[model samples]
Target chain A: MSDYNGQAGDGMNWQPGLRESYIFDRNTIEEIRRAASQGIYDIRGFGAKRKLPHFDDLLFLGASMSRYPLEGYRERCDTSVTLGTRFAKKPIELKIPITIAGMSFGALSGQAKEALGRGATMAGTSTTTGDGGMTEEERGHSEILVYQVLPSRYGMNPDDLRRADAIEVVVGQGAKPGGGGMLLGQKISDRVAEMRNLPKGIDQRSACRHPDWTGPDDLEIKIEEIREITDWEKPIYIKIGASRPYYDTQLAVKAGADVIVLDGMQGGTAATQDVFIEHVGLPTLACIREAVEALQEMGMHREVQLIVSGGIRNGADVAKALALGADAVSIGVAAMIALGDNDPAYADDYAKIGSAAGFYDDWHEGKDPAGISTQDPELSKRLDPELGGRRLNNYLRTMTLETQTLARAAGKSDVHNLEPEDLVALTIEAAAMARVPLAGTDWIPGRSKDGF
Target chain B: MTTATDVEVVDLATTPLRELNQRLHDGAAGGPLRWRIVNPNGAHAVAVGVDAPFEIEIEGHTGYYTAGMNKHAHVRVNGNVGVGCGENIMSGTIHITGNASQACAATGRGGLVIVEGDAAARCGISMKGVEIVVKGSIGHMSAFMAQSGALVVCGDAGDSLGDSIYETHIYVRGSVEGLGADCIEKELKEFHREELGRLLTAAGADAKVDEFKRYGSARRLYNFNIDHAGEY
Candidate 1:
């Protein structure tokens, strides 16, 4: 037995070698060299690239011998959601649980904002305003609009606040929590400059924290002030990143917030340092339970609605989030993709800018070939609002159908009835993090009286 | 008692602010030429979103956001305001007879805010094109991250004044505790004195214009300088 030493038959028998560079992988070496040469951190759009525990780790247990399943097409599974019912004089009602997350008009074109509004309106959902301010086009097209009051207060006005159906006071973002917003000089077009009241070609950096308040007590006063200004007709939502969801939710509820918007690390940003996007904040899977626990502890589980965002891509993700105790879910990057971002039709244009179809993340450069993120007039003309709106409507309808299908299989009458009992984790890490029973076992990893 | 002009008097105690504001906002073209609000006992959002070319007279103290988003309206508050006295004023004039709380005239785009008494912290913050004239001192971090326009303080400024400021010009009659990042004292030239004098007259200040020292952007941190990212 010559130990199979014959290499000629195996086509030269090259050994499979692993690169011995932990600190200098190809991508990491490129980043290091780029940072050293440019003397600045790399800034780009999109969410985190590093993988984390997500909804895919959990599986729903369909109806079996003990439970009877509902008919998929016959039995009704309602998905309607009502937000801001706690303190708002008028709460927002949506036919579906999915919403369009905030993306600023400055980061996106006017046509794109209009498209988002039209699509969300047609789909019977709500759209949000992002950093710079609300546009009239967005307001006119959207049936229900959530106006964001950011730290910058760029185009904030009393009239606009009154006009909005709901108000979202943004404390932090998932991409760069506690970091200010950055819109480079190239993106600051004339209209954007006029709206934000900045010079046309100057870089605009928004404030990291609100200038008016320093603590939760002052936030209470500020919320009250907004309430007084709007006569309490609109719902006030507090949006916080997933850094400290438990305490943030508690404080927001204490400050009399009608709704809480929790964005995880996977949430997309128009522009931020690549390092912050990947390294900061908690995973979406880890954020939900803590926020739900906080709300449950305060006896505000259902009284104050919880809207979760950050990497929600489809109906299963929506169902999983709802099962984990979220009232609704919002989407940003997925919506843009459905609206024709990173399309193959613009591959040549992307190639001209040293990028490819699915890898383009230079939204801050103001050269988007798909016309969704850029402010260029010619590029913006490429996107037709009516067509984009139709595509978004189709996507939303599909997601709703998929969610309803899952709910029917689980023998649930309503989508909101999906509970943690119906889900099981595929891995021990997920079981411990999501606090669900591991696959066929009756045990959750960390549920014992003594530490596991 | 009706004034000579087209004056509509509304007592805050009787009329709801929503109804009154709706009437005022909806009827801006056909509404009264002037409005006089009485018995405003620290009411919030008094005379807010008044877009028409009119005049508003508040007889008593107002809460937050008094005359906020005032477009083409002249508002006069007889007593002190709680906070954000003239926030986001587009184009108009807000004259506060008494002291102002934090963030007075914040993010004002195009207007004039005249504070008769002292202003608290973050006064004239993120101000753009709106001239804010304070007759008395301003608290810490006044004019913080101001993008444009001019902030005039007749009295002393608190700590870290004009921090990370942009093109906004800060003129002070009294001492400044310290200059913030990228903020420096500029030589008060003849043109600056003239500008300060005009602002003083507009704000109804009796202080000498030449006694004020000017501070402005040193042109640092205007672009994304890596060395200044720490300040950001």
Candidate 2:
């Protein structure tokens, strides 16, 4: 099948010159063939590969005559962020606005989890645990770890909850919001089986909903039970995929969350159907304003911290999300990249698995040459946690420095001081979603004249 | 407020729920090991999250998540209990004299839950390793997705007794309305009968093991299949 090199076109009247039909493109034909033969939907890892309106569509408006810009080298731009300030006695204090998002021990290697902990600690930030229970490698290395409470409740015990620095109740994931997690028998090792309390080598299916409770009312009780179990010491966060941000954020707030973690469609998954990842949740840019508006409407914008994730790469994206009113940001796929995932050095090994270096995303296969996403003992030893941690730290430092550069250009001393007026959209779709004016125009599409 | 040797009485009418839980967590370090809570009045999260080994008794009704996530504690509620009673329990003993609400003992792991009266819907839902015995009937969707545990019911069960169950052993003496997808009735083997007899005797229940039927996972849906693509 042909790759996207200007092959697809709108015109399809017995197309000549190798011009492919837009609707029935080469990829679509290949997918149909595979489905007809295999009779199953294609399941893969990674986030949405399709292009959408992103932070790149928004440009920062530097200071000119009306506004004064700060000195590039001399001015200090504060990047510290304090999360979970609404209800917790002990909140997270980060040196940078970026944090490492949750990636499970089962989906990722134990060494990779260790590396993330070591790096986040070096960067003066926190790392989060994912669908699987907390492993000692991460908990022992990480200075501050946020434990996740998912629908499956796998390896969910009171001891881990008490030891966690914070708790995140996962309502849904961005890649598959209403879906459950899938771990093929190939990935469920002896440790994974024991931890999850399931049989060895049996395909595991995580339930989509919490076993005890159903909706918001039950969410309140669940949060309360967690708080009670932890003695009300740790901050409680509610994570929602970007489906209906306005209502979900409000309900999470009402459920007594100290922080809200919003993940968009571009958020990465370990293993899920390809169709659901591409079609489900809203884009990161589309949900930021809506979520921020919900928090602002409740007068809890900064009081209850908002950590936005999915498609976050560098400092510009970080600044754009913050300018759109997010308190902080979380990174998952970027962190994996920082720890040497999909690096060109393993191109030879990747090719053996029927993939190229940058194109390889079969994390669920558990044969990752980089040792980051696999459970194979031999392959896992390829990653040196210390070196991976250093690389991740360097990447995080660079992103922080880049964010400071952007903040200085906008004449701001603190990163959080950047406002919506400092940015303009390069496209109408982005302008409508980000609620920012289009470049060289005073109008934001679909916004009312009264600005309400 | 009794002294050192006596059972301390905490009246929910006068005291706060948080205070009672805190006292329970204190775990006889400063007071008596036995506690009697009065005027529970259907309060949610009553006597929850106590990891310490203590005997807690509630005289009146309690609300959601009562004795939830319990560890090593023995709790008894004389009146009715609300939703998610003894949920995610690690190790404990919970006895309820009155009927229980929905999701009772849901996701409980390694515990013994006994309900003298009927249990509402989704009873023992997703139970990991807990042993639950209900003297009366259970509502619909009981033991749904229950993973390694045993649920015993004396009276009739509602619709969908064991939907999508995994490894959980269900023994019902009375009639079962129906079995759910991926759940089927299994023959009562000798070991199962002995296990049922032991569980019944442990719960102080007077029931014959010969009249009960066992239901468990059919194991057909244990792995994914291309032919059953529509199920997903």
Candidate 3:
């Protein structure tokens, strides 16, 4: 094998043992070198700096000597949650406090959506449609389906609405608020375009805001319209991004929304400007507290269900979200991971795409290596639906089990009963937002006057 | 004229919209009834999926998303309509006798929508395969990011008209204050003139086709070259 350091030189004396000048950390230098070599203006569409507090900073404040712990296997730990009781004629009763958030068929493939529905059904949860209308395959596969009514109003059908288990009125997504949904032209296959009723191979723009309503008052009428259409049978969920969550949540409740789904900045999207994803919205942790506070102020806590999403990765994240006053937690990126997002087996293909194992995020190009987020025929085919579904089921089960473990440790019999008192924050920001005590201290900021 | 046996009138104020829609979905009861929706009362999603080739007439101002996802049926709204009128219609004719709110005929696959009055922002946005003829002015961001199909505005178009358009044809008789990203004015050729004339006649607009200006995509933003990728 030829040595990489061996250089062929004519009449040149070089020393291979001498080291160069040392400066910054080698890892940091490597990052800068890679970035400079790529000459990319700023990595777009992939992971970037998000303002929200990550899962690492938050810790669970498990029950102490004062509380009783439940038996791991013998005691009943109910994870079931009910959503949209304030306005819905029939609230949603979920087997677990985990539901699949809205991911459009236009953004993803029909097979992927079917797999999501299948997995969610197997997990005894609900699946939601995004900007695109309800597909027969997805609806048929999903035991409980939440139809989204977006600003674009693509594929929205009364028949589907009547057939749906619930409806989610999409005001905005976490990735980009007041920003339209984008499915780049390359991924806009004929079928996807047809489903959205747009032209083939064109970047589809879903409207950022509702057309008629300029404020909360008009939203009331809009909500009434949806209720009138569905005959008040299905729950109406109003989803908002984590921008001004306190006010938005209150407005959503005032608008007669049955359920409120709050998404934070870390939420995933099919296509969004990297700038907007990183710079626009608040973190999921901050948003959940504001939403919960708003509901509590109105005495609607647990009466109007609150679902939190964005950056939820594991069972610990789900349990923490519930403890932060969320009735349930929705997962998008984590679900995509379960569908094989960053698997190491596709290293060669990733290299071919000018990326490596942990650096591949070309979701907009439809050339995804892991087969979870791509419209390319070959790439999509790499994902076997059965296997993908099984994997998702396994991941979901593991998360449920982990949540049960945490619940038992917290001396809580029901997962929904997990309250804000069961969590603590390692940072001042998290403590203030989640209304929990600082790590290693029994003092909470607002609850105890002398704590600060 | 079709007989009364072929017509079914439902009062939306009292009758639950779901039951009415269910009846319509189950197929026309007691013959093919031209559903005369009385007392719409700002109700939304009226006659949304009439796939049986029937005709429905709404006599009042309707709320958000009226006649959404229409399929194989003709729907006529006698008064102004709220947001997303005729949204994602597959194949049908939606005639708005009065003004339509924002995103009129948004993402419709195949349909003929004639709006007699002004349409609010984002009119005909992401049009897809629909043909929209607006006799009056449209609001800001009209036709913003339209993917395909034809939008004929007899009156002036608002700011940012046809932003990021792709393969879609926009014909405006009056001034367009602004053009959206990747959208540029195109020469009004003979074919476009004919198309404009046809749309004008269909919409019952008396405006001369020669007066209209056509706009389309510049086609500069399709490929993701390193030079232009950061602009977004």
Candidate 4:
């Protein structure tokens, strides 16, 4: 076979330009270019994008000469959040604003979900259940668990609903807005099947929509049902895809939701079509502003808490989301990375799976090299839950620290106090959406008379 | 005239439902308290978290989320019910003598719910372990994403019936508009017949055993193959 560069691997006889002209210094770039030339778009596996204006785009607008900074060790900064107060008589008071988003048992093993709960508990935050119903291990480990009620209704139960700290009625996910969940048959182990109440070996198709009501009017009733089931004790959250966010957020609030979770296109999933992930929903940055505007317009900004997810990777991303008007941020892909996904040491096994290092994202397959996303016994054995939980905890702590550092630099004592004025964007689209100045200039195209 | 405590009738009209619930919780009333709830008109979350083993009777049309999260309580609605009636119910019984709106018994874990009239879409969706018996026809996407449980329909079922159903068993006597992806018609074995019979008895329906058809998963798309890469 020819070399990847389309050149023969002759011993000591190869000449320059025998394959092709190379402009980039890194081999990864070359591989990307080669793949792109063949109609394959280089997809994001895990890492910050080079082209986009991420959380680092804005600087902390520190306290001015007139303002005084608090002593690092002496002063206190609170990061707590209360969700679902509108309907529930008693709402959940989270220790931290940062919470773990829902990740299902079918997409990941029971061990992974357990680890997530454990890590979030250690970090003084909350964990969530995904499309699948509540598992004993997940509910037991999480300090404050948010049970998700998706279109699929897998694993849903009254016992779990009563037991949950909060309920999230998921209208749509970011990865595939109008699509259903597809847990390929191979990944459906006996335990998973039992939990989901499906056959042992069958491709599970989660419904794209609820069977009962079709519109917002019906949603109000759905919310009511959940509150009644929980005896109005637990809060209820409404989660929606980023598409048509302004209207969706408004509808969610009108439907009696106490908390609204807006997920953008960058959200990762266990299984979704490549076409849908890349082309379906709006970006998180844009969605946050729209959601915030909707809440602010209704005079229910802080009253109806907004939790934003999709593509948030680090402390900077969390800070940026907060600054963009989000009450808190949820991270899914980053959490998996912290659990040892995309580790270079697993290159050999990745190759065995017909994929090389940095090119493995078929999470639907049970033969995952990273133990976080597989049901296969061999793959799952490669991971140690204790170790994984520790790593995730460490990562969460680091992210919190980074967020605090940014908050302090911006002259704010609390992470939630960071505002949009504290940041600027490098790109025109980002600047317009975030309502900030363009990098290295005072121009704001939408706000200013002279467009940038 | 009957004395206030003569029939042990809980009047939801004059009394706040929460206070009545407290009264029930405190053991002030027992032995199937006859609840005469007047003007139940569209009140969201009317009868939630009722754990007492008593019977409740809603007089008129109830709004969204009626009889939600019920545990060991038998609730009866005299008129039509709104969305998500008896959702996430754990045990006991809920009987709608009239038509039921959307999402009847959605994600219910246990207990038996019987709808005398037509049920809207998403009936018994994501039911963890509940048994639902509908006497009339059901709307689109009924029982979509059901996990484990039993749903018996004496009338026709709407579109995308039993989509992504897990261990849940469905028996329909009437025609099915469509089957959801991966869901297929299965043979009505003896065990299934017995299960349907039990559900019918619970729902107080006199439907015949052979009248209903069974449905389940086809068991394809379990493992990934390079050839099937584009299917998703």
Query: Candidate 2 — what's its lDDT?
Result: 0.89
DockQ of each: 0.46, 0.70, 0.34, 0.43
Shift in Å, residue A156, candidate 1:
1.5
TM-score of chain B taken alone, every candidate: 0.95, 0.95, 0.93, 0.88
Q: List ranges where model 3 is wrong by over 4 Å.
A: A1-52, A106-111, A131-137, A152-159, A197-202, A205-207, A211-213, B1-32, B35-54, B60-64, B188-194, B224-232
lDDT of 3 by residue, B1-232 (tens): 4475566788888897777776766664445557788888877777765666778889899877787767777889999998888877778799999999988887776779999999989898877778999999998887766767899988899899887676789999888988887889999998888888888888789899888889998977664445665543
Per-residue CA lDDT of model 2 for B1-232, tens digit only, reads 5555688899999998878887787763656778899999988899888887778899999999999999988999999999999999999899999999999999888889999999999999988899999999999999988889899999988899888788999999999998877889998999899889988998899899988999998887778887655544
Clash list (residue pairs), candidate 1: none
For candidate 1, write residues A277-341 as lDDT tens digits: 98999988888988999999999998999999999999999999999999999999999999999
Candidate 1 vs 2: which has more lDDT? 2
lDDT of 4: 0.78
- Listed per model in order, the count of residue pairs whose N, CA or C atoms clash below 3 Å is 0, 0, 5, 15
**iRMSD, per candidate, in listed order:** 2.6, 1.0, 3.9, 4.2
- Which CAPRI quality tier does the interface of model 4 achieve? acceptable
lDDT by residue (A161-268, candidate 4, tens digit) is 878999999898887688777787888899988877666877776778775567888888677666655657888999898899999999999999999999887787
| Per-residue accuracy of model 2 over A1-452 as CA lDDT, tens digit each | 22432255543544557666666776788889999988888888898888889999999998999888889888889999998888777888899999899899989999999999999999998999998799999999899899998877888888999899999999888888898888877888999888887777777788888888899988898788777767688899999999999999999999999999999999999889999998999999999999999999999899989999999999999999999999889999999999999989999999999888888789988999899999999889999999999999999999988888888899999999888999999999999999999999998998969864
Candidate achieving the largest TM-score: 2
Worst 10 residues of 3 chain A by lDDT: A1-10
